[model samples]
Target: RRRGGGGGVETAADFARTAPRAGYLHKLGTNVRQYKRRFFVLRPSTHLYYFLGPNDAEPRGCIELDGGGVSAVRELETMPDGRFRFEISLGGDGGEGDAGGMDASFASANDDGGGGRDGGGPRRIVLEARSAECGREWIDSLRSESLPYVRAELESSRSEADELRARCAALEARVEEMRLVERDRDGAV
Candidate 1:
């Protein structure tokens, strides 16, 4: 029978298989538009962790990798119009929100075609990858690692919504009952 997640029995263990699901996706800053080779790791349920190097135990910074925050990870086929080096962008996924429609899922780092498809979400982050291969690996790893958390967050959101609906229904019933009592008192007076 299914456990925690109904029918399928998806669990935390499923998301937390092993550490360092993949290597770093490299790093880039748009302000200066520079590249930095930093090692990265993801906890799937929590953070997209980056360390100064692979050997470092602590993270440099953790990007919120959940659905409520970052959206999708895609490596641009080629550099966006102007600039040097390849890039991988995270967020929105161009409103596709699905495997078929998303360009990031298909495009290769060095191939060449449009930039990222992140729509206009403020959270979107684009970073430089040294080569096409590096961008591909980062996209694959980020896409795979982030999906489970998104599903879980969606499931949680749905449950909360249902509960809120129930509460609203109960409040409505109570308000109607009070109104009826008020009418009865008016009539008696």
Candidate 2:
């Protein structure tokens, strides 16, 4: 739940480094509406979703959560649906992520600024799991699955920043040395 520059810190895992989390859940079902059960694979490294249900051998829809693009996972208590519902708040410019599979969600992103990567707006993905325990497990798994990468990225960014600061200090010292030499020469002349 760290806040990033765009907003909250997102979990962008290195795709090649880790295994994806897979589960079966009911999606889009509200109190009144029926649910569609789908087998989803969440790749924390790329922050992409692979929705492959029992019927389809191949993934049906792929979504990219930018920068591993999730800020918060909260239950939608306000909604009338009695089902265990949670929403994944998306931050950063919504990227197509590298899903290989895109659907109406990808195509429609341009219309509502939902997937814009310009750091202008925010998007959300709401999912309703059949059970509350399952909902919690999903959240926990998602966070922990991305923990390694999050730590890795934080270290990488910190090191890069430190390196830049050191470089800047060296440049400043050189400037100071040049100024001293110029002053001494002027006095002598």
Candidate 3:
């Protein structure tokens, strides 16, 4: 398992070509609860990946911002040292613990000194940014990227609501027909 500084150094052009948001952030370890600096890259696909370093060929872990993988992203109160932080709450059925779909060795490495699972069910990952402005920018970028998933969900809900409304209308029409039949029967009697 690679530590913080094993990968190649990233150039400005690399950042420009790869992702809009790519930088170093201190991630709170799940088991140790200690903060470790990791290089994160937020992709256009709504996947936030953290590497041991900027040039790692494969990501140590990935957090899917769309598809119910992420529940929320919110800024946290500043630390006593004045560090701006944010939390990413993973959805219930999201990645495996704090490893975020990492392999066993990678997860174990993180568990020992890096990061790990907090507990059962949905979990949250806290990341500290270099500054308040940077923190807010990261949050905004994450929220914006995840909007597609939210829009898709909204579309689904609207379709369901339309179906329910149609069902209700049909039921009301059936009730009105039954009432008419009852009135005719009473007149005939």
Candidate 4:
């Protein structure tokens, strides 16, 4: 459980080099509702959740908690190129975090001077669900099956990018050949 941004001082490169923990994938449940509920029980962990928001520009969103008072929010923006560009930044001094506290019970959780986490103060999470069904579905996927699906989608995208590059290279070669043919014809004239 780290405190501020400076608290979790691991460099991005160091984080990438770290191996996934054992039983990390196995802990996930099959049902979405069950998974969302699990977060309430998490002792020390971080998770990203994908949320479909109001429109096309806001398809995917995320929630992250690192067992400390600090948390983050991200909104996914869909680009014209069929890719998602993330607009992400951590809230300063738990400003954005205040939204989750709208629910009365959450305040009770923080009633004590210390928040839920061990030795930490005020465990805050972001919550935004328009309707009950939407909220339920979002929580379920995040807790249960979303991780595997996201990984698979990333792999498929990489493969598609490789295929597209090969096709572009072939087209360039054909264009060069056509140019050479035109130069030969001009020389003959």
Who wins the lDDT comparison? 3
Which run of 10 residues does model 4 get worst, by summed lDDT?
21-30
The residue-by-residue lDDT of candidate 2 on 14-45, one tens digit each, is: 21125456667655432334446656677664
Give the better candidate number (1 or 3) by lDDT.
3
Best by TM-score: 3
Could you tell me which residue pairs clash in candidate 3? none
Off by over 4 Å in 4: 5-133, 136-145
Better candidate by TM-score, 1 or 3: 3
Q: State how far residue 149 of model 2 sits from its true place (Å).
A: 6.2
C-alpha RMSD for every candidate? 15.1, 13.3, 9.9, 17.2
lDDT of predicted model 3: 0.70
Runs of candidate 1 with Cα error greater than 4 angstroms are 1-17, 79-121, 147-189
Per-prediction TM-score, please? 0.44, 0.48, 0.60, 0.34
Best-to-worst order by TM-score is 3, 2, 1, 4
Model 2 local distance difference test score: 0.55
Q: Over the stretch 1-189, how does candidate 1's per-residue lDDT look in tens digits?
A: 134555564232332347546454545544444466556555655456555655443344455455444555554555564322433344443311221221343212221122334456344445556566666666666665675656877899999999999999999999999999999999999
After superposition of all CA atoms, the RMSD between model 3 and the true structure is 9.9
